[model samples]
Target: MKKIALLALLLFLAAIGLFLAVVWNGYEWHQKLTVTMDTPNGPLSASSVQQMRLSDKRGPWNPPEGSGVSFTLSGEAVVMELAPGRYLFALLTGVPSLGRLLHPKMDVIDAAKLLERGEAEAYRSVTLSRRDYPLLVTFGDMNDPASVQRVDPANLEASFGPGYRLQSMTLALTEEPVNTGRVKKVLAWIGPHPELKLSPPTGRTSNIPFSRRVGEGDFIRGKT
Candidate 1:
């Protein structure tokens, strides 16, 4: 009877040890990642953007083992590189949620995408006015890619995803801004731009599981 009890106790201890090891590794492996991106405008100054962050470890939302994870693996931030003349928006990845906007094909996701996956059930996004961010927009000729004939924030737009709740932060723009000159050439791409107004909402716990398809930034065409 004593031998049987001792063996059982040993097995229980081993099981607990294994459990702890798994937990520790999970926490370590899921540590957040950070990255930067340059858009047609100046670095979408961090203070001028809205943000949302959340993650879920289990389930239909998570990538298959060895497939690479999303939110839990990286933190995303989107910054525009708009300039006075001749500016190009380079894709910025690893920003917690903004990454999803740059490349949906990538394994990662933004706050809204995670919400779609059911990871962020309480996720709430608000659409604000473009008057907030300091920037100017020129409806460039898609044919030239860099040809700017006029600058019109009215014809000018600073929108976000075509449908995502993602909000844009406010930045100062040049009034009566020029469009045909360098200002026009700079900040060219216009697939709906969003200024990332604030940090995305957060869940109380990481274990909050999720899965689904929630689109962000109808900003590109969402408003139209």
Candidate 2:
């Protein structure tokens, strides 16, 4: 009870702080940053920088888009205002200067299955805007895009960590043939958290050992 009360107070304080920042800071605080994919040889949208993820035709996965664009806060430029929701950085233009996204036709679903039955090792790798804190990622496929399926955070909090919503998901990039096992291994390498709470597509879920599911809503649309 004491812990719960303290947690509630903290949440309330955070909400108030965010509201103040939004009101006082205005768009200036959240003004989007723009950069070019020098190799792209074209123009692009500034929004992708905080929303872009390089993946197959399905979208949103490892390696991230815009290899030439701002990779993260520490990349081409620095990020000033950080938020709690999901963000991606792209090379203004989706197309990487004439270069194309690899494995544009691969299926994230199949890649996930391989990761499940211990047959695949595919994973998504990308940099983050904030370089200070270790970022937490919740792997999502078709079956459980949110990963948690809106069950209870208590079920996942131990593995994915707390205060982290869905930031982004990683998908396979090789189409001709994807070594799911290998991909998972790669994702595990860049992934700050090794113990993944893999929630298979069968509606069942499992925690990697270091995650905790604190509640039901832990599986927010983006966080799950």
Candidate 3:
């Protein structure tokens, strides 16, 4: 009976230790900023964004894995931060939720520089079709082994069917924190490390598209 009680206490202590470790590693300091879109009507706040990509001095450092960091939408802005390095911050917007005025736009900015400047702006104009298909395509034939052709706005009508329209918008980023209380500031020593499994590239292409088709739903649903 005494042995059983002692064993139970050991297990409980071990569990508590594991939980504390997880909390320590997961915590991080996040910077906050507001996003706004300028359109024909007027300036509107960007409550949420579709996707965000980050690249540090080493290379691509995506959320929850590469950098173990992700952005959170708070009211009318986003909260996030990098792990003490210069980085390129890319944000993708133009989902159905934002309305037709906004189209798929990828805005890339130098994070450190933008922070120092206090603001940054990006402009975009793109044509989109009603149907869902690949916007870009690569083609090659056995007869032309050495020749490969790439096409943008691919010829396939399915890729660009009727209901085609053009969209133009401007996005602005300001280094302003709306809700300071929501920001989580963790110590640098306890931050999580990158969990990348693949080895770094050695003069070879590392980006290859999957055979599957990805759409707006995939982005919103967090399926991709």
Candidate 4:
């Protein structure tokens, strides 16, 4: 009886250790960002999404298996966890018809093709601020690939019909400001420009997370 009890205790400790390891790894892998979709008229279901693509200007890519950006579709909200970096988000969704949009015949569509075809449902430029830790990006939701429930690829054509459409996209910033020149260049390269402009920083202060450094700007004054 004593030996059985000892084994049970050891198993319990092992489980706890495993759980902690997972949590630590997740924290190190990527930061979580909350994204809320805003439609002019109303919110739509996540099921409308077909796939999502990300680009860092090197090449288009999908969420890597264990440690790349992934999405969670909860009702009208989609949360994405990604390693901190600048990224272009392409939202692919279904539309009733594609009169002018190019219909590519492939499983994974390249982001460039989406641009050339003018079929991208939504496009957004995101820069994850290291200072803000986990950044929050809220905008209109598009078709997300990482929803809790996914549609079978075999049934996508049947589900969306032959006229699935890709349209609408935008870009915005939160927590930190980015270089204006860089933003312009990126937007021009992406082709579909979102109706966004940099706004003056709000003069708000907070100390709960950490105090803002005073006289820090003096060090780099007149350098830029």
The TM-score leader among the candidates is 3
What stretches of model 2 exceed 4 Å from their correct place? 1-48, 51-134, 146-224
lDDT of each: 0.30, 0.26, 0.28, 0.26
Q: Per-residue alpha-carbon lDDT of model 4 for 63-170, expressed as tens digits?
A: 234334222111111222121232222222121111112223532224333433444352333332222221112112222111112323223223233532212222
Best-to-worst order by TM-score is 3, 1, 4, 2
> Candidate 3 lDDT (Cα, whole model)?
0.28
Compose the digit string of candidate 3's lDDT tens values, residues 1-224.
Answer: 99999999999999988655554332111132233323334443322222222223222323345443233222211222211221111122222111122322422223323333433232122223433211222223312212222223223223223432122222323333333221112111111222221123245355533212222222122211
| CA shift of 70, model 1, Å | 2.4
- Give the C-alpha miss distance for residue 117 in model 2, angstroms: 52
Output the worst ten-in-a-row residue range by lDDT, candidate 1.
Answer: 210-219
Poorly placed runs, candidate 4 (over 4 Å) = 1-4, 15-20, 23-69, 77-224
Write candidate 1's Cα lDDT for 1-224 as tens digits: 99999999999999988655443323211111111223434333322222233333444434466233323312112223334332222111212343343334755434334433433332233222443222222223333433322222332233321221222432111112111122223323333334431123355466421111111121111121
Q: Is candidate 1 or candidate 4 better by lDDT?
A: 1
Between candidates 3 and 4, the one scoring higher on lDDT is 3
Q: Is candidate 2 or candidate 4 better by TM-score?
A: 4
Better of 1 and 3 by TM-score: 3
Positional deviation of 138 in candidate 1, in angstroms? 15
